[model samples]
Target: MNAGEEPGVVAMDVESTHMPTNSEEFVDAPNFDLETYISRYEGFSKIQRLQYIARRCPRLKNDAYRLAIKDLKEGCNTASYKEIMATVGDSLGPGYGYDAAWCEAEDRKAAAARERLELELNQFKTNLIKESIRMGYHELGRHHAARGDLAAAFKCFVRTRDYCTTGRHSAE
Candidate 1:
């Protein structure tokens, strides 16, 4: 209780509270392995987790970004790749494995694959084959997951349950 203050109130000492601005202050695990750590996650989560780690740990930024770039090459998440590249542009310097040509090529390939899968799914639906329809939905879900579209992947995968013909299909 201080002068002119409420009887039940206490003045707060703002300076006594500590907040860390530097990432180095949070680096407690010096032996952290980014690869092993990221292996537990899949799809979009893997890239997101890596980006989070990169932002929080300056020492691991380069390694995290490098691994993220490698993962991006296998998926159709060009926007993520570009965003990550821009975030680490100054820190990573030039020629840090960013390829515009590869992005364009990968986008084309992904689009073509999506079109083919959708066409197959439509054919299966038209034929009224339960097994084929389920399989078609499963394949489309996988394709969407690989392209980093988690919402679409979840919807496609959920549709498979409606056409599941057996306990095994349901389990899968």
Candidate 2:
């Protein structure tokens, strides 16, 4: 209904609107004010500055985000740590609280990468060792047979048999 239209008379210009049925359709409104916070404690120490940022921006308090910020600052410490800190704070602003989530995700990703690399390395080592054992067995068998010692050749061939077995569950 139009705000000033009569109860019995519908306004031809009034448009009917449907309310949103899902929360996902709603946009999050920006609620944090970074400039005001910076102005309030520009004279504070480094830790104090971080604490204020953490309080003002809940994302900054997240372990991942804080660690990322710290890492970034340390990387630039050789030049000027304070400048790096200021830049990170300015860049993050109200987004600081989610920093920990981002950092945690990154850490998880890195750990997975390292695990994959180690697995590949271990596989490579296993293959190399297996090949070496096979070669050694063949060489020993050939040497014994060349000396006309059939009994010794048979023993060497048997010892080399264990190396051909596959799988981690196979005998060492």
Best by lDDT: 1
TM-score of each: 0.76, 0.24
Task: Give the Cα error of residue 73 in candidate 1, in Å.
Answer: 1.3
CA-only RMSD, every prediction: 6.4, 24.0
Compared to the true structure, candidate 1 yields what TM-score?
0.76
Score residue 21 of candidate 2 by CA lDDT: 70
Error of 1 at 92 (Å): 1.7
Model 2 regions lying over 4 Å from their true place: 1-87, 90-98, 129-172
| Structure candidate 2, residue pairs in collision | 58-97, 59-96, 59-97, 59-98, 60-96, 60-97, 64-100, 65-99, 65-100
Per-residue lDDT of 1-172 in model 1, one digit per residue for the tens? Answer: 5678988776888999788776444454579988999999876899999988987787898888988888887778887888897787756656575688988998899899999999999999999999999999999999888877789999999999999989999999
Model 1, C-alpha of 52: deviation from truth (Å)? 1.8
lDDT of each: 0.87, 0.47
Q: Candidate 2 lDDT (Cα, whole model)?
A: 0.47
